[model samples]
Target: MLSNTTPSGRDVLLPMFFIGLMFFILGFVTWLNGSLIPFLKIVCELSNFQALWVAFAFYIAYTVMALPSAAILARTGYKRGMTIALGVMAMGALLFIPAARTGLYPIFLIALFTLASGMTLMQTAINPYIVCIGPRESAALRISIMGLFNKGAGIVVPLVFTALILSGMEHVSEASLGALDAAAREAMRNDLSQRLVFPYAVMAGALLLFMGLIHVSSLREPVLDAADAPADAAPRQGLLQHPQLVLGAITLFGYVGVEVIAGDTIALYGHQLGVAHYGVLTSYTMGFMVLGYALGVLLIPRWLSQRAALAWSAGSGLLFALGVALGSSGESTWSQALLGWAGVPAVPDTVLCLALLGLSNALVWPAVWPLALEGLGKHTAAGSALLIMAISGGALLPMLYGHLADVSGPQRAYWVLLPWYALILFYALAGSRLRRWSVA
Candidate 1:
């Protein structure tokens, strides 16, 4: 029941540019958790398990708010919804002012939750809007183009943030901190906490500015042609009856889990492996993701189908995981060489795997979304919300990885990504085609 009406070139071009900007904003704010995980661990004096609450509090908002976000979007439409979302995010950004002043870890988590709630609404609006704006067959290509904006911000935010706050942090450690007197420890915590204030204040102001811009922008809502309406009037089944959607939701869950682990945990993993510039190395992961997005923009739909892209991404991820495991055991010279060539010569082999994992993750989101929502018609909004909810995998899986790092070693903790990628492979191969529910 999806609208088959193709947008004019101008119609697509103008909205895509603004939507791409929105995506860039999402990536800049979302991926900062990569730097923040290590930053908060030091500032708040947290265990590995405890620090991952950064991801938990941020992503859990999606699971809790996605349905409500969809309902809000249904009433408000995309432009108004986006304006509201941006305003909400600006408020969340302002919460950091109090959080930094108080230096309370829980307050920081609350601020993240508030920020993610706004992002949840924004995503719920923009994703389906993008799909309806173009040909269904080329949805992957369009989304991949947006991925470029997203990952471009991903690449820059971490580098700039690391330079701003995490510089000269190589000498700070739990042992070194324990050796410091109470006054010195308190002074260090205050300094670390205050480092985030200016950056977040800038973020708040920019978000507010964007809210005003979107409020006045002339973006149009998608217009569904009459011919695209469902032919039958039979009662539709619940969303659970669509097997492809259910499986696709699970695929997104696993995809986001591994992607979050690769991006967010790599710094901590590299630090544990004695890598001095691990903060900068985190940008390398986003860089590879940008490369993969570029490739997806080039190859998807024109040369390879979205399904084929997913297959290749999953296979590459599996191979990378194998390399990481083998390199951990010192069984792969090639893996060691790859890590050395990546310029983190002192980093563990597993950190290299984490960076490369970004390549395998790059196309999954673009591919999975179109495949999942292919025939939902009027149900598209509800389906999109479900997919967004699956992003809570970002919340849960990294916390599990953190706990595993605490119990085992960071090198061995990467074993978690293997099963996640394997499940994604299954979805690429067969699960996406399992549409039991009729579109009518």
Candidate 2:
């Protein structure tokens, strides 16, 4: 049941506004990795495998800090936890100054870890709060609405990074670096790395301001009671006994992995395919995500339930993943047909298929959260933490893709996403419904 004190209709607007802002913050910081990957590859003189540790260090923090976030939210409440998270994130943003000054890859990874730790806190607090606030049936719908705010920022973060950092900077490939002497290469790297100092400074200040704003806001802590519990709720021995939530976490693991690949690696692959505007490639994926969220907002619960939407998303992911793995590397009619007349440059068929994964992935996170926690009752907090921890998929899978790219090539590396989508397709079809580990 929905909490009595939680807002409804117009009353819901204020709380949603604050949560939506946090989601925007999440998207902005997270999606920047796509641009940063190619940029840092230049600055740090790293291989594809080494560069993807950018994602690894960032997302691994969720697994490390999610349970701690639950404990902190238990005491400080959601509003205070979010405030603390922003302050922590601001500190991490300020850390970028030194990282830029020295141009040390390890320091940059440390900064990213700090930022993700804070983001983990924010996500742990907000996801359950959003789910438990409204009618249970519409929880997926509510999350999809939040997805608009989250992915809406994804659509712009890379473009902003490009305009601020990549523009006017001399582009260098690992291939081109061989021509430059050591001193000259070091000088160029220092100059390129220094560009980050100003933007991260600005980001730190914004995070501090947002922290203060959240501290002063009137957001309510979510009140989860027995009303939210399902009748078949199991004993609290361990959350592992619950199959729906566990399977959902696994589903998220795969979902976020492929989703990260789609959103973050498109630029690298585009650059490899000789696309000129590769830096802004993440925007294509995010744009498709925004469109998918809009469709979810309109159609969910009204015309389609969350489970059905997940099925469709998974199927689309399978088709698109195959396209990415096997489709033409040459420029295709897809981008021209879809975005050409809009004055947008056309990308290769393979890159377009990779971008389409964002559409297939848009709804999985929102739909999985509600379905996973459905019967948890008193254990919902722990369940949410577990789901949040599963974001390590984003860390691990991309590293795998990067390694595969190095050994074989970036194009064939997309084959890694096939099994991931297949796992999610399994969950949407059958796994989300299981209560115990049995065949029931």
Cα lDDT, all candidates: 0.85, 0.89
Candidate 2 lands at a TM-score of 0.96
Give the Å shift of residue 141 in candidate 1.
Answer: 0.4
lDDT, model 1, position 19: 97
* Angstrom error at residue 32, model 1: 0.4
lDDT of 2 by residue, 17-131 (tens): 9999999999999999999998998789888999999999999999999888888887787789999999999989999999999999999999999999999999998888888
List CA RMSD, all candidates. 3.1, 2.3
Off by over 4 Å in 1: 1-5, 225-237, 329-346, 437-440
